[model samples]
Target: MSININSKLDSQNSFWDINLEGELDVSTADKLKEYLHGLVEQEVVDMKINLSSLEYIDSTGLGVMIGVLKKLRTNDKEIYIINPKSNVKKIFTITGLDKIFKVEG
Candidate 1:
């Protein structure tokens, strides 16, 4: 029903370490978009998102990620998805997003 985002910035590496927990559907997608956008505005840096604890995600959540990826690409930065649950990983694969973003174990 809700999503929990825990994020930290690694200043030395100039990237974000973000962890997602709970469901990421229409209800929660906007929050993530806003958070990521705020970070993007501050600096264009790579983001590594850990999805091991994420229970679910819908199209809207995927859209938010795509949008952020697009923004980051302009600066030659990228988003790395780390440790996604099998179901979530399947969605990315089916949507052809896995090829676009770096999906690491």
Candidate 2:
């Protein structure tokens, strides 16, 4: 399945609220990159990524997220992951990424 990214910038916080749906895999990783990078270029640094409707995510997808986080850190910014499904949550646990990233229910 393709990934869908819906987003809106919050000027007050200099951040964005981004919603993700469908699957995040190798095929869709670029979409994530493009969307996040586009936001960053617009000076929107921090982001709250809503993954509640995301059904699946592959390793490539995870890697893209990590890359984005690392890049954001260089700018003193961050990304918060929100409302991940159980299976996707398990992937974060197994990968030990939950400890690295901010995840909110």
Candidate 3:
């Protein structure tokens, strides 16, 4: 399955909420990287990625997220990941990424 990213700015909270669906694998990792990098470049302070609808993810996808978090940290920004499915959550936990990034319910 292909990955799809839908995003919108929350004016009231001044944060960008990104909803990701479908699969996040090697092929789509670059797309995610570019999109997230653009947001960081634009000086977005807070980012919330909703992964509840995401059906699958690979190491590349996780790397893309980590790269984004690193970029944000450089700019003193923060990234929050929300509602990851159990399988996906396991990957984060195994990789110790759960401690590196904020995961919300």
All candidates' lDDT scores?
0.95, 0.89, 0.88
Candidate 3, residues 49-88: lDDT per residue as tens digits? 9999998889999999988888788868788989999998
**Ten contiguous residues with the weakest lDDT in model 2:** 36-45
Better of 2 and 3 by lDDT: 2
- Give one digit per residue, the lDDT tens place, for model 1 in 61-104: 99999999999999999999999999999999999999999999
The digit string of per-residue lDDT tens for model 2 on 1-105 reads 698899998888778899999999999999889888888788747989999999998899999889889988998888899999999988999999998789888
Q: Is 1 or 3 the stronger prediction by TM-score?
A: 1
With candidate 1 superimposed using the best TM-score fit, by how many Å does residue 59's alpha carbon deviate from the native? 0.8
Count of clashes, each model:
0, 0, 0
lDDT of the structure predicted as candidate 1? 0.95
Model 1 is weakest, by summed lDDT over 10 consecutive residues, at: 36-45
For residue 93, give model 2's deviation from the true position in Å: 0.8
